[model samples]
Target: MENLKDEQQNHHQPVKIDLSGSSFWAKKGLKSLEANGARVDVYWDFRQAKFSNFPEPSSGFYVSLVSQNATILTIGDLKNEALKRTKKNPSATEAALVSKQEHVHGKRVFYTRTAFGGGESRQENEVVIETSLSGPSDPEMWITVDGVPAIRIMNLNWRFRGNEVVTVSDGVSLEIFWDVHDWLFETSGSSSGLFVFKPKAGFESKSLSFNGRYGDGEGEDHDVEDDDSSPKYCHVLYAVKV
Candidate 1:
């Protein structure tokens, strides 16, 4: 019983992260995006992103359909990325959260049960992107993108070693391999997030990709456009050197 108690205490203990070596995201196309409509582009890869001080804190990305605003969710640790944090204190009566559990560190981790409520009908324009974040059904991480159905995600979880890959498809599949195992298990290094999505099938041909790039000279202004010529600022790139 004493040993079990010790383990439980450790489970709830705050994760001491070397703030200097944290993993977060900043894509490479924000310059062009912000110029276009007060746009806010954020990228976060939860595969390696750490959340401190919460039992089963849902860390991923989230989007508001009404406003078309999107942001990544984490435990509030990032070296170079803008932290969009929202705290929810739901009273049991108004509880939108249900109970589900996962065991990560020998302790059971609880997750929220959520049913992405329905719209009156399908929106004229709809987009979906699978982050493969593997959080509670009540996804805290939601974003805009498009894809048909399921695709084999062998490289995403990578045996729970933190080698993850996120792929999106308009039927034109784009994959983002979050290359990080050292940072996830080692010291406090950082990781990047890639957000990709396309408009609903046939509704629009254009696709969107956000690459959160980091490293040396991480803050220098850079531009990202589609592969085609003409500098048609179709995609937004955001790179943050944390």
Candidate 2:
């Protein structure tokens, strides 16, 4: 009886440790993303440009639909690319996170959870954290960015709740605007509709070949017709530097 009581006590005790070293993300500031998944010889060339933190605690992670009926969700961590991999035989609610930093440079932190049966049994939405951060999911442990709570999730379909106020991991902030509509692509002859985030002023969007296509791919180049008279921008390139 005594051994059982002691074991129960130890299991129930809150596990506390210095989060500064553990999977803790930047509370604020700038972030740089290095491409590590590709060949090291060409990593730098294929490196993604640095991006600014949205300045709030948020779950504003990004996802790319790699193929029909499949999506690749990511937290934007670049140092250890494998840190985002989903473990084998993971449960339906598999929660994993990574946190790292260096004195000379800012840190990259992130976490993700895959719930197989959450979305009406037809579709599934993955939750992600795009910044290096650490903390339990408790209301008392609220996170703040620029003195205000961060905008975490931007579900255009009104699926997720509880994270109503967006939160920035460190210095990242995202503006939320969404519209629902239907469209068709002539290339694949597939019809799909989804939401997209348009980065704030001064931030640029680059196209990345998720699965097929290559550098100088069609639509990668941007041009404005002389009659339209709109500002012409450079083509968004998407080739792995590796």
Candidate 3:
């Protein structure tokens, strides 16, 4: 797991807890630690965890973080199992996933899964990004959600940096932004594209404007005054063509 934080501050370093295999520590079943000055108890069972190309597991596991007698963060599909093992009620102010940053390596197509909406209505959708950077035809890009083409950009060399709004589900929509200047202009083969997916409900007003860049680079930095009121969901994907 990475950046396990509480309500007050963010933890920079990742905390690795081996929950799989028959190792001595893994058999102990529970691990206790401190993050951001808060006591956190971690409960996990990844013996049957399923994974794809990503390092994170897809399903068949549970990782729960409990603090102050409440389950603050729970990951995986086995939420009930995590709650049963932790013996704690879900926190009233549960920690929300604010943003996810992924570095994906692919030649033409990049695949990822993301959940849209909040609470009981939240649904996970398959996200696929396909680009034709060097072909007989003009360069183009296609972004699909749940097997449906959400956005298609033609003549990508000219329209490399832009944003669009697409509906993902009945009531859920996403404001997608893309910046592929490096992929088209960089002579060095180490080119990557930046794609930002933000929920279209109250996200623009809550979050700062995206400056068409990712990570540490030359850009004007905008600070959010109220951390508590900031948008709680954003997905930033760095697609590196190899």
Question: TM-score-based ranking, best first?
Answer: 3, 1, 2
TM per candidate comes to: 0.22, 0.17, 0.63
Which scores higher on TM-score, 1 or 3? 3
lDDT of each: 0.25, 0.23, 0.69
Specify the highest-TM-score model's number. 3
Per-residue alpha-carbon lDDT of model 3 for 129-153, expressed as tens digits? 9998886999999999889999999
Q: For all candidates, what are the clash counts?
A: 24, 29, 0
In model 2, which runs have C-alpha deviations exceeding 4 angstroms?
1-165, 183-189, 198-242
Evaluate model 2: give its TM-score. 0.17
Candidate 1 lDDT by residue in tens digits, 1-242: 00011233443212111111122334211211242265533333344443433332234322111113422122223322333221222111111221111111111121211111112221222333233343543212223333334233343435221111233332322322222232223335433332222112122233222244332224532222234322111121111112
Between candidates 1 and 2, which one is better according to TM-score?
1
Best by lDDT: 3
Candidate 3, lDDT over the whole model: 0.69
For residues 1-242, could you state the per-residue lDDT of candidate 2 as single tens digits?
00011243443222111223222243222222323342111111113334333221123232111212221222233323322322212111211221111111112212222211112121212222232122443112122333355444333224211212132343332222211111211234322222222222222333322243222223332221122221211111111110
Give candidate 3's error at residue 121 in angstroms. Answer: 4.5
